[model samples]
Target: MQITTEVVSGLERRLNVTVPAQRVKSQYDARLKRVAKTAKINGFRPGKVPLSRIQAEYGQGIQQDVINDLVRDTVFEAIEQEKIQAVGMPNIESVDVNDAGLTYKALVEVYPVVTVNSFDGLTVERQISTVNDADVDTMVDNLRKQRQSFAVKDGASADGDQVTFDFEGSIDGELFDGGAAKDFKLVLGSNKMIPGFEAGIVGMKAGEEKVIDVTFPADYQAENLAGKLAQFKINVSQVETAQLPEVDAQFLQLFGIDLAPNEGGIEKLKADVRKNMEREVKSSLRNQLKQQAFDAVLAANEIEVPKAMIAEETTRQRKLMLQQFAQQFGGAQQFDESMLPDELFRDKAERSVKLGVLISKVIADANLQVDQDRVKAMIAETAESYEDPSEVIEYYTNDKQQRAQVEAVVLEDQVVDHILAGAKVTEVTVDYQELLKRNQQQQG
Candidate 1:
């Protein structure tokens, strides 16, 4: 076999391979002999069919198989001979199998050579957070709200009241599509509906009928409804008042705190909640620092990632989003791929690919390896929140795939730590609530 190579623009190369006609004939004849061993045809027994007869009957498919095998067999050797690191599978094209030779082209993306001077000059912020008593108090209030109950009340609905009503909305005196409902339940202050829609129901007594004007926000998701004036004709069927249980034995017990008549069970509950909050705060702090480290490294590096890697990453991200949607909405097969265009994930994918290349370089230069002790500790921390942590730990420990996933995360954390070690780090104290808010905004 003889090989020639061409650089087809950035990161892409084409390998032209040609096996001599004699070699092609040799492989073809060998395949024909193998086929004849299992050959079955009229007036011929197995292993007795003529090679020429088998070739005549199945030459087309056998030729394709031979070319495919040759392409697989020779392309890597050609790539090695060219001394280029290929990223993914080569796309074979311009295949020709005949008297002259078996010739083809394999187009592939070559991996770029990565270099980094130093992360020492990179600046990163170390988030310093302490989950205080006030945050714990806020969390306690939220927990109470979660366990809050509602009761049927014959009175005006106010903020926090659950209201069941029927309403038909109209624009310009004409009812619009999806502008009506019957016995739709809503919390007056939940903001589940458009601006003014929920507020309009506040203080509305059961059995009251009214029409209120509402203007959709200028940035509303529906173009037709955005900034448009609409009036809703509403009938309030029922209003239910929220009832939060007092901090008593039952409420305390609801949180696994066994209250004693003369003891400070509420304080005990707050302490327990505070411990959980502290755990969350610790995790949040680590995540914030890791993110900062990643941003520092990414900002400091300029790398050109292969489009093929970006494309693959984009596809993986799209499929992950679909999987999440399937878990949330229960219809994986019903989703249309076109709903999520590749453009939606392209930029993120490119950034991720670039950052991945940088992270890999850091790992290589630092000679980093996955720490099994940290892996065990991370797994233990994760399983701590479960009812039966031992079972969860056992499940993860015994499942190689799951354990490897955790190990990968551990190594990523180590990578972040190494980067931070080299970075000009400064501690920034952030309030717990402020940190949470910032995290939410960043995620969005």
Candidate 2:
């Protein structure tokens, strides 16, 4: 066998391989012999068919199979011999079977070499936040609101009030589907309806009747009603004001807290809430820092990402997106994979692949390995959210894939820490609310 490689372009290698005719002949003859042992024909018994007849019947088919197997086997052998780190599967450009030999050309994309000088000059801001008394008080108030009750008020509906009413809507004097409801409870300012529908319900008193004119937005999901003006005839039945529950034993019991010998009532609850909030704040801060570190490393490194890798990642991302759509909209079988265009994921996939390459290089250079203690800690932290933390931990510990996934995350964090160790870092203090708001905005 003889192999040769040519650099077709960036990260792409065109490999030409030639297998000896004798090798092909030997494998073909062996396969023919195996087939002939059990060969059955109209007039010949098993194991009695002539070689010429068998060749005449199955020669081309057997030859094609042999060539395909040889091509599949030899391409990898040639790649290994050339010391190429191929990304995705290779595309066979051409194949020839002649007197000279069995020759084939394979086009493949190889992984690029990544280099980083130093992370000492890179700068990133780390957000610092503390959950103060006011923040805890606000959280407690929000919790109270979660368990709030409402009582019917004999007055006009107002913002933050829940109104129960019956309404019939029509467009251009003709009623449409889903344009009417009875005894529907709507919160004023909730924006559950069209822009003006909720506002129109405000100021309405029980037993009062009115017609509200609302224009659907131009980009409404319902094409027939988009940009159309509709009139809703509504009859208000009730208005209710929110009533929050007092901080008492009942409220504490609601959160699974009991006034035992050592457990304090509201104070213990507040402390637990504060602890959870602190955990969450630390998690959010760590996520932000990791993202910043990754972005910094990505910006500092210049590497040519393999197109094949990007394409593969794009395909994976597209499938994942389609899966999410299926889960959100219906079952997996309900949607077609072709509905999502590949271009939708190209940019994200490219960036992800580029960063992955850079991170891998950093990990190799720094000799960063997945820390078992950190993996266990992460698993424990994750399990803290579950009712049975021990069960969750056991599940992860027993499942190899789950444990590996956690290890990968821990390894990535190690890389991030390595980057932060050398990178110039600046701490930026932010209020808890401001940090949360900024995080939400970035996510959005």
Candidate 3:
């Protein structure tokens, strides 16, 4: 066997593997002999089939099988011999089989040699914020809204009011599927219905009967109803106004605070809310800082990521997106990958691959390892959110993949910390609300 490799382009290698025809013939003959020992033939007893008959019947198939096995085995051997750190599976360009030899060319993408520059010159701004009493009050207000109740009102429905009604919608004097409902409850400003639907229901009083006209948006999901004016004969049954729960002992107990300690549980509840808020604020700020550091590192270093790696990452992200869509829309088995274009995720996949390469290099250069203490702490922190903290901790400790994911996160944070240690970091103090608003904007 002889093997040779040449560069096709950036990170791509063309490997030529040539195997002796005698080797193929020898293997083919050996497999035929083995098959003949237990060969099944209609005209002859089992194991009594002649070699000539077996060769005449199964020679081509046996030879092809032998060649496939030989090629797969020899390709890996050649890759090992050449010390090529291939990314994805190799593409066989062509195969030539002659009496003299069997030769094939494989196109493979090798991992790029990544060289990360020093981070001393990189500058990243770290935003710091504190969860003040006002932030706690806002969180408490939001929590109260979450636990709000509703009371049927005699007056007209308004914004934030829940109205229950029976509606029959028709377009062009013809009723369509899913155009009618009985006793459907809708919030006036929820926007659950199409444009003008909620607004039409608003200001309607209980026991009122009215005909509301709405025109569907041009980009509506239903083709039959898109841009069509529809009339809904609505009979409003009841209008309910929202009533937020008072922050008292019952509410505090609802949040697992059995004892108040002092100040009629309000102080304790505020303290707890403030603590959680502080933790969340700190986490968000750390994430922002880490992302900035990651961007800085990438901007400082440039490396050609292997197309194979990017392709693999793209496939992974595409599958993840499909899974999320399936989970959200309830058609996991029926979802088609074609619905999502590759171009949609190409940029993100490329950046993810590049960052992965850069982070790996940083880890190697800095000799960073996953800290067991930090891993334990992370597990504990995660378990805090679950009902059974010990069970969650046990699950992480026993599950290798889950633990590895956590370890990777911890290791990435270590890399970020290492970068921040040497890099010029500017501390920017931002208001808690402003920081949260910025985070929301970025997420949006």
TM-score (all chains, Cα) for each model: 0.88, 0.86, 0.83
lDDT (CA) per prediction: 0.88, 0.90, 0.90
* Tens-digit lDDT track of model 2 for 1-444: 898999998889999999999999998999888878887888999999998888998888888989999999999999999999998899999999988689999999988977876998899889899999889888999899878788989888899888999999999899989999999998788777889999899899999999999999999979999999999999998899888999888899988888875779888889988988888898999989999999998888878888888888999998898888888998888777687788889999999999998888888999888899999999999998788999999999999999999999899889988999999999999899898888878875
lDDT computed for candidate 3 = 0.90
Off by over 4 Å in 3: 41-50, 165-184, 189-237, 259-264, 325-331, 334-338, 383-402, 438-444
How big is the positional error of residue 367 in model 2, measured in Å on the Cα after superposition? 1.5
Superposed Cα RMSD, model 3: 3.7
For residue 122, what is the lDDT in candidate 3? 99
Q: What tens-digit string does per-residue lDDT give for candidate 3 at 75-110? A: 888899999999889888898888768899999999
By the TM-score metric, which is better: model 2 or model 3?
2
How well does model 2 score by local distance difference test?
0.90
- Cα error, residue 173 of model 1, in Å, equals 2.9
In terms of lDDT, the poorest run of 10 residues in model 1 is: 255-264
Which pairs of residues collide in model 1?
Answer: none
Of the candidates numbered 1 and 2, which has the greater TM-score value? 1
Off by over 4 Å in 2: 165-184, 191-200, 207-236, 318-331, 372-402, 442-444
Selected candidate, larger lDDT, 1 vs 2? 2
Error of 2 at 414 (Å): 2.3
